[model samples]
Target: MFEQSKKYFSYILNPMELLRTKKVLQVNPTVASPRAEPEEIKIFVFDYNAAQADVRELKTVPECFAFLDSPKTTWLNVDGLRKVDVEKICAHYGIHYLITEDILSIGQRPKMDEIDGLVFCLLNMMYFNEKDSAVEIEQISIVLGKNFVISFQEDAAKDVFNPLRDRLKISGSKVRQNGADYLFYSLIDMIVDNYFVVMEKLGEKIEGLEEDIVRNANTRTLAKINMLRKEMIVLKRSIAPVRELVNGILRSDSDLIEERTEKYFKDVYDHILQANELAENYRDMMMNLNDLYLSNVNLKMNEVMKVMAVVTCLLAPATVIGGIFGMNFENMKWLHTNTTFIIAAFAMIGIPLIMIRIFRKRGWF
Candidate 1:
């Protein structure tokens, strides 16, 4: 666990690695990898309604135009972002250049905006990287159009959309029966649901750290506490703005979001609200943990001091007797006599015994 924590913090210290498009990692664009492993841009399409679904991967940016005007609800899941490809797809889909800029910008805060006929949402999608036992954030920017929704992710492979895609594949499912708004809701709902997963893992770690602090608080424990506090802050930042994003969807007057889908988005709003509360609680708990660590350290220090005081008291009689016997005067009683020396030795040992007995009786360490 300590090793895992060290590795995790190494990633945390480098904010650029977490916030920017992964340009160095090789991830298969067709399969989902951890959020850290996306290198190239890829696009996936899920087009469906109540009757049937068309699922395929696009090799070029222009392929997306075919679904732009299709009667079926179309969801373009862009895995990674190349500036040129993003500009081309956004232009073809009638998306504003500014929204495209937001997509290209990898670190936008969680927010919602309405431009012309499109409703745009940008939020961080949280993932727990099991390999390093860390929380990873990927920015997802979604644009809801007349009959289409486009999701842009900085990572090429990592997402919480498989189950949602599975629902789209299932005939007669609510996702298939509903319009594009419901599909949009499902996408946001999946993102919100993953928030709980990541938070639950954080809660478990917090609980574990609390126990560890109580049992044995050490420097490593302090490090872990600091690390957790940092993680909590990140979670809070990512989660707090999302409440507004979800609420914006609920309060949006965009025609892209139909009346019937408001309830689904409302459900998502409730979930984000719950996640927000959890983040706040974790933040408070982290502060409490720091205090607890200091208290424990002080308590341990006091224990050591108490033991030293008791030992010093026990040795005081011996020190005084030895000091008396060392006198240079020839008239000193036990200076040269064996029996007197033995008596002095016994007295030195016996006095400390008595003092210890009295001390124990008084409950003084």
Candidate 2:
């Protein structure tokens, strides 16, 4: 046992052996796969008021700007930031260069800033991708001005703002009755509400892992636990900043956020707080799951050791007896008689049986 422990320490202390055996790297690379293609830009314009609404798809920047001067609240939704000259649109709205830069950058953290009567906010939109069985994150940049709101997204294929558009189609919708600020609040509210969907999927995954840890803990399960832990970290990183952003908006003195709309912002803030708390809770649960998985692995190792030790114990006496009788001694009592050989055979058999019985009574095997 001492020699075995010495060899274990030697293996551990050797730098080359440690380097070869340990998994020392963990990374999630951001490069796109070879099969992926660049996405095209899609523009959606919504012009609405309490009395009337118009929705259309625009192909050019000039067409998008046509509704900008209208008295009604106009919302321009731009999806897929690539290949489009965002500077021209920003120039048309008097948007600052820094704000335009933030809009084009795909991975900016959530933040809110007000400049010269314009309110700019950056947010992370998260959802579970069924095809990949992973959480997908997209950046959403919103600019709220005097009579228009422009939203920029990295993907042209999907968004959560469809419900608000559906509501706008109805006559006398609250979103239509209010100004651009209310529309801004509704967009933010929809984004915040979608967080719950992502959280629910995460919760389900955690529960499934818990069951797996209890039923069978193996290398695959361990890898899954680590994956989930990393995902939870990502989720927390995505949410914590948004919570701060919403809090900043709620406390800001910007005139772009009206007094009546401040209450709606507060509601959005509360939702973010709830989502943040849920993320923290899930993180704690993942830590516990990791601990549980390690404990199960150790327990399995202990069981294997017990079985091996029992086998060794059962064979020990028989080996000793056989070794003793096999020695050469001409004058020995067992050397001259066939009975002696028979007695030795019985002794070997009897000793092992006795030991096995004793071990059984002690519940050692």
| Candidate 2 C-alpha lDDT tens digits along 102-154 | 77764566899987778899988888866544566787999999889999886
Residues 1-365 of candidate 1 have per-residue lDDT tens digits of: 99889756856875554442243233353443333434567889989888889999988888888898899999999987777788889989889988887777645668999997899999888887766556778888989998888998876567789888888888978888888888888888889899999999998999999999999999789868866766776688788998899888888888788887888888898888898888888899999999999999999999999999989988999999888887788886556766987888899999999999999899987
Q: Which regions in candidate 2 have their CA more than 4 angstroms from the true location?
A: 1-40
Enumerate residue pairs that collide in model 2.
none
TM-score of each: 0.87, 0.85
Error in Å for residue 223 of model 1: 1.4
Clash count in backbone of candidate 1 = 0
Total clashes for model 2: 0
